[model samples]
Target chain A: MNQRAAILSLITPAYLWLALTILLPLSAMLYYSFLSDVPIGNREVSWTTENYRTFFEKAFYSELMLRSFKLGAEVTSICLLLGFPCALALAKSIRGRTKEALFLLIILPFWSNALVRIFSWTMVLRGNGILEYSINWLLPGTGPLDLMFTYPAILLGLVHSYLPYMILTCYISIDAIDNQLLEAARSLGAGKLTILFRLIVPLALPGIVAGSFLIFIPVIGSFMEPRLLGGRNGTFIGTIIEDQFTAVFNWPLGAALSFIMMGLVLLILFGFSPLVRRLK
Target chain B: MANVSVLNLSKNFGTTTALDRVSFQFEDGKFFALLGPSGSGKTTLLRMIAGFESPDQGSIHIGGKVVDHIPVEKRDIGMVFQNYALFPNMNVQANVGFGLRVRGISGSEMKRLVAEALELVRLSGFDNRQPDQLSGGQRQRVALARAIVTKPRVLLLDEPLSALDRTLRLEMEIELKRIQRDVGITTIFVTHDQEEALTMSDQIGILNEGQLVQHGSPVDIYENPQSVFVARFLGEANLLRGQADGKNVKLEIGGTVKTLSKPAYPQVICSIRPEKISIQKEQEVHRSNGNRVAGRVNEHIFNGTSLTYLVQCGNLVVKVFVQNLSGEVIPPNSSVHLFFRPEDTLVFPDA
Candidate 1:
């Protein structure tokens, strides 16, 4: 009984903090999602389901959501493809002080402000930017490659922002794998590709799944990078939601849209949960 | 099956030489053990043979072919690590059939071969069980099965039984020998456990400080160890420093020691195993053409089946092992006579 009391006392503060921060706001959002209008400054309001109906009935909202999900998938795939090899090199090829230094470099972007990082990408990606200048300098006769405010620019910023997550997760799992297993495979006549797919990839699947979830969920719900980097091509479900709250002052629509996106994300996660458990 | 031979194999990691100029022939279809303590380069030699680590100065020949530049997979050898190294992601059957599958052998042939290999290791009908589900001994068996399934030219085991418990280790020793004999593959096993090496291998090579100190059969290595390191490493040895003349040596402790073989140097150290020396109460009559010494019993240890008495002869405390057939215990401070045959005494240079 004393042990139980001690555990309860230790956890109660954290639980209360989470309730205040997450649960209370979520409850307010749910209530606001059902209202006809913003319940602020003594404005008259009524409980309604029109905000949710707007999301399902309109083709525009669903298309934007699909586009947002596509962007998330593309970013996740690119991150995984680029990050897994870096992680393997970091965890296996390099060793000692070099590995630690490389690891620090991989996570260095996280130390800087995300907004600053995104804006820095814009400066590098604009028409007369360092990338175009370098290409023109190398080729001696290249056109102005104005890559700013494009879909690729948003992808570049997001991948840079989230690549470390994939690499770190993969490095952790791959590093935990014993070198003896690889040697054993080689001794049993397994070639390089065989070792990678049969041994390393399967053993590192948990990290791949985890990294994918970490990158995908936030990218789909992201508004800042798409707005700053994508410009005219930046219209996504997240931007529409942002307009509903800050620009249009339609809190009910924003709340409903946030809940719908949460539901879809939860559904996607639920669909892949069985695969993750099997990997474990 | 192929005989593996290394010719003056040498390797150095930074300033420390991991393996010196070592050369040995591991006979085909025989179980050979590389026995040594830590930092003795036993594992490094094994890795060189397995093609995991290349030797810097020597060539490794498998089946009379110099395989110095061959990659590990192309070398066609199977190895079992100390940790077993079974793929945790694979089930028993998948793990066992990995080599065969990688070699493009599938369908009923793969199934039959995997089954036969598993049955050889005595882990049959465990097709779907994952590696984490098995015990340590069982995982080792699975690793063995996986290694031999592809019928590689040689099988290398790196201290595979050291991870098991005492009783399990003993059982696996016999089991491993049986499997090796049944498969009749050229096997090189590396281990630090002298007892395990002595019990299982057909040939034993003792190493110390990156050099091969001695290589012989188990009985021969035990009976004739050339240096003090091998004499003490393989088993306990009692050394007596003395001045030698031919097969006889005048001891500093006021007794004469004899050896069947003459010593080359005037100064010699005679080694005698504890069990070879017989102890009797000083009052008993003794008649034998052997070296005899009188000592006071310092202490005796009762080990259920045998008794070891620490006898103080002059300034030396000689250990003698006696069978506990009569259940007799010798009290401390009693006078005793220790007798050892001249043939049982081994002579080495004093250096």
Candidate 2:
């Protein structure tokens, strides 16, 4: 085959899969979002912009969307702050098979079922659970901690689920940094903190950014973790969208909300794309 | 200015010894080269002095104060790495100002000092260029500028010129010495290149097999290497084994060559530099300064300004370098006589 034919053959499968799974669904959603009702059986359907109008008119929906975005930002921030150090330690301090093993442990959570992992947190975090029991055992008479089924419970679960993405990104980036650069920094009279703040943080920003997006995209669309761990406080935009699709049968409203969330994600990516390209 | 000294330093990496009981002192305001082959512990010793590694058994003193206990950041030394590790994220100006900034010397004064350093390395206009944008030689200059901007007490260079091309290396060698002289900081350089060490350093320390074979002025070490390793490592040396008797030695190649040094042992080996040996046609008879051996020319290497003749004697091929001032070139397979002075021969007791 010619080069053009060869290149097309290589890319056709991926593009075909994406078009089937994404483009068709998105186009159908957009069309359904503009309709007044579902065209089931032989029922007459009418075109309307009421589904999008309902989103702007409802204060509850807007508040939920904002809350979901805020949650995403908070979890992403915590993951970055915590995972960056772990990655630095893994990439710089440890070496050989030990490094490999520790890295494997960090990414081990991905291999198992994510829902199972989220559910496991309840065993450790519930009132009179392992965490509370351990503290009470140490103190001899401490009361129940009442840890699970709260906002913090949801935050913890989200961070645990997504921490590896941050760490893996940062590890690949930090590991690529030359040891000579660090040695040169120290030789020039820069302290450990100075080397970290001035050299490492600035150099590893690309990883931090890429990891943030990876967590942010999934965390914003999440309903399973919040539903299982968040209890009453888990009523974010994702849950509301789930309610529209499964409980309310408001397919048009659900389609509109999904499109809006996707629009927000695209805006964010566009806003930061130049910075990422420059860093590269 | 500070004179750095290491006393009885040794380091081991598991089963392999990187540096073995090495002791040396760098005098104030001098350029010293730690010359060795790969895995000869030259880089290890440099790292120990730079505080990247501590010795397993010994103390390091900088300006009469023990610095082995001190950390690298507090050691007040500058290092130029082999790859010229300039920060790729920053421009030349920021890179040179990093030491000053970390030390809390900012503002216009920092700018002035950074500019002066860039000027010192002749990189004044390259302040805005990042490391990736600069050429290899330019990046090296930026690294040098960054190293010396803080006026560090001592400078350590780990094969600083090895990354450059031959012509660039020669150019940088002259530039390095000029900047070193201008700054006059106590500098210790490391390299496996013999000619670079000889050309760039005032003093040379030769290392081999994790041991300090010899250390002295470049001319002293070159003219008076004390071991077979040192003699062979420092440039090209022709080794001739013989039985020593008083001022004359019986060459293995069937002749008694006169020597300037007397040996007490019966078996001795003499090192003769190729440049010290002269080649002449065997038919032409003339008095030389010392010993002469008859041989046939095996090959002649024309090196533009000089010619190297590989002459075959009894069981040995002796190398002779004759200056190419003569218009006529000697042909191969011709009989020739090799003359070398007794004072030029360095004798070692063969063990």
Candidate 3:
């Protein structure tokens, strides 16, 4: 009985910490989502469904939600398409210290803050940035091109930011594939393309799916890239939520938008559950 | 069926020579076992034949056509790997039908051929079972069935039964021999197990240090091994280190022992099989042969049907196998006399 009591005492601190830090905040957010904004003095209290009702009633909010999902999906698809081949090359073609160096290069961007990376992209895509300058220099006849505050710039930033995640995940998966299976396929009259498609790709599906989700979830609520590179027309749901809290001083509405984002993430998680189970 | 000829085959990886100027001919419809220890270039030779590997400085001819430049898919050969190499996602039927499908065979003909191949391996109704669902022996049979389903002219097997248990290995060996006989395809089997090679191969080629030491029929290899490596590798043999002079040889053990038969070389190492040495009581002996040796029993090991006695004469220890007939037992530390006919001994050049 004394040992059991001691063991329980030992486990109580971590359990309490998790409850206070994670579970408590999530439950508070859930409760705050139901509260309505007070009319005056930028305050909100009491229970009402007006915040969710307003979001559902407004076409702008719905469009923002759709645009967020579209961007996330596009970023995930592009990352998967580009990252898988890069990872395969890294895992199979490179060797020794060269392979290690390539892996480090893929992961090097993740060490810096995402805001700084997005700011760098903004500097490059601006009207008189290096890209426009280089284009003007190379073409000579063409004038400076305006690339800032564009969808492509935001998409480019998002893809560049999350590509490392996809590549690393894919590398782990491709590296785990048995070389014997490829040799076996080759010996069994399978050509190089057949071996890659049938043996290498199918075995690396789990990694690809995992990397897709890792990049998609974060890109869905991305704020930095859209704010810096997208400018006025590049506003995302995360930026709107940030404006409600910091500029508008509507904590309840901000919490409500955050809850909606969490719900969207949950929907993605639910949609991917069956795929993950099937892969396993 | 086609004959495979490897001429001056040499493969070098960096500084290590995997196969050095190896050349051999596998006759049509002949079951040849490339018997050797590990790292003896047996599997390399098999892979070169399968076209999975390209020899550094040689040409491979199959059916009088140079196939060194041909890819593995165009080689038109079947291969069974050591691990069975069955695709985990595919069933036995799909695996067996893969070659046919690759060759554009479909419909009832493919199904019938796959069925026939499965039936040849005695696995008729196991079509839907995946490789993971089958036992080790079943998987091996599936590999064999897959290899033969295409009716390839040459079949390459790389230690097909090495992963199986002893009983399963024995059963598969018999099955393999029966299948080879039935199909009548030129087959090359690679294995490190000497007993397996001796039991199943019509011809065994012994390889050592990337070179073919000896190639002959099983009887020829077992009865008369040409080199010291072959004699030591095939089975247990008593190596009598001696200097040959005319019809008499001087042994390191005792005085010169006269040979009833002469060797081709003046100095040679005589190899005598353990079973060739016969032990008898000194009082029961009627006649003495020139090849007979006097020794005392140092140790005796009972091996179910026979008793193996280690006889020590001076510094030489020779093993002799005696059948345990009439419920006779040979005790260790006993005085015994061993004898062997001169014709039973084989002499090779001393290395």
Candidate 4:
């Protein structure tokens, strides 16, 4: 028919699916967050702000939220530090079939199940496990080096799960950079570190920021890795929210906590939007 | 500013030789051009001089100092890439000041130097504009400013003007020459365009198949080309293979062409430039110092300023250029006499 009709028809299906799947569920959660109790199973519920009030009134929820943010920051920073060099090597130094093979290996983790990967880490990290046996084999009778059920174990697992995102994004950015620019910088008397910090890193900042967003947002809300790798030490805001919905059946509190976490994330993203704009 | 010299520099990429024992001296305060076709190893030679590519068989000396072991960063050279290669993240000022900043020159000194460089390239008010925002010519100016801000010992340019449009390229040719003269840096650039090398360089070195075929001033190389390849490459040349005796070449087309210089070998090729041959409708005057050939005009290709007439003489077609004066053209199929001086007929030994 007309151009407007044509455009609407093209976009209608995808938007319709998103509205039904995401927008409707989110609206239901918002309504549940204001209720005093669950609105099902013959429980008399009234609309109230008590569930949200409990989150502010208690220090437990804020502390767990801060701890989750800390964990996200640590994992994201570690991923950037490790992944950027690997990406630089893959994009700049390595070539041809080797680079392609390395790239395949980087994303190979995604082919297997995430739960299986976390469980496999537990087998290597537990007391007197593969890691301990290898260490003691190197230095005999060095005692049981147990890292299981610790915060480090959870950090390690999350980093392992998310590092590929950082590398792939950074590779795209670094690869797009012209080699002539590097040579020009060197001819202008820029040494290795200067070229890296000034030319290469700044040019690749968009990728670094994108990778952080990809890893950080999901990491703060991650529940499985911590639960499997970290015993009691893995109790984050994610675990508390999981307990609220699945164990305690406090749907209202869980909805309120999820909304609060989302608000904080939006604030953080909004604060750094200028940096992203500058990259563009 | 210092003279740069490469002594027998050679480079091989796998099995193919990119540069083969190519050696030349680029005099200080002069503009030198490495002219060649694609894959002729001119770019490879420039890179060797710039310390980007190392030679397999020789050493490079800049200002009489052997810099084979010196790294590119410490070479103290300035290079402008073909695509400008300006840092997209920084503005013009930052890009120009990067070299100085890396050398630990900051504050007012760095700013003043960067400003002077931008002014030299006529990009004074463009300090805050990013590279992508600038036009092709403007980005080129920024690249030039960035290259020379630190007052490098030698300047290397890799086809710096090939990215610009034709009119812009012509303008930049003069602009680049003036900037080089003003800075007085020993500058060397690689180009495949013969006109660019002829118009811009103080000395031109022609490369063929990774070897230095001929090198001299523009006029020397154009007037007295030592080889057939050099004679054809610099400009349009009408090559006629024939038997030579003393100063006359008996053409295969049943004519004898006289030359001022005798052929070194019995068999030689006579090279005559298109512009050197004059066309006459009536053959009446013989100056006794020139060679003449009778031909019929086959075709006339006309431009605004000049006309190229493809004249067919027997079994050969000879090209002759005439100035487009009086708005007249010798019609095709007209019998004409092509006249050129004996000295204009360059004789080269055919191998």
lDDT of each: 0.93, 0.91, 0.85, 0.93
**How well does candidate 4 score on lDDT at residue A219?**
97
- Of the two candidates 2 and 4, the one with more favorable lDDT, higher being better, is 4
Best by DockQ: 1
Tens-digit per-residue lDDT, B52-101, candidate 3: 78999989999989998999887888888888888776788888887787
- Per residue, candidate 4 scores C-alpha lDDT tens digits across A48-150 of 9998888899998899999999999999999999999999999999999998899899999999999999999999999989999999999998988669999
Q: Cα lDDT of model 4 overall?
A: 0.93
Identify the runs in model 3 with alpha carbons over 4 angstroms from their true place. A1-20, A37-44, B258-267
**Measured against the native two-chain assembly using Cα atoms, what DockQ does each of the candidate structures obtain, in the order listed?**
0.90, 0.86, 0.54, 0.86
- Model 2 regions more than 4 Å off: A1-6, B245-247
User: Which docking band does candidate 1 fall into?
Assistant: high
**Which whole-number lDDT from 0 to 100 does residue B277 have in model 1?**
92
For candidate 2, the lDDT comes to 0.91
Q: Which predicted model would earn the best TM-score?
A: 1
Q: Best to worst by DockQ, what's the order? A: 1, 4, 2, 3
Give the per-residue lDDT of model 4 (tens digit) for B154-242. Answer: 99999999999999999999999999999999999899999999999999999999999999999999998988899999999998888
Which pairs clash inside model 4?
none
Chain A TM-score for each of the predictions: 0.97, 0.95, 0.90, 0.97
Q: Cα deviation of A98 in candidate 3 (Å)? A: 2.4
Clashes of each: 0, 0, 0, 0
User: How accurate locally is residue B121 in candidate 3, as Cα lDDT from 0 to 100?
Assistant: 96
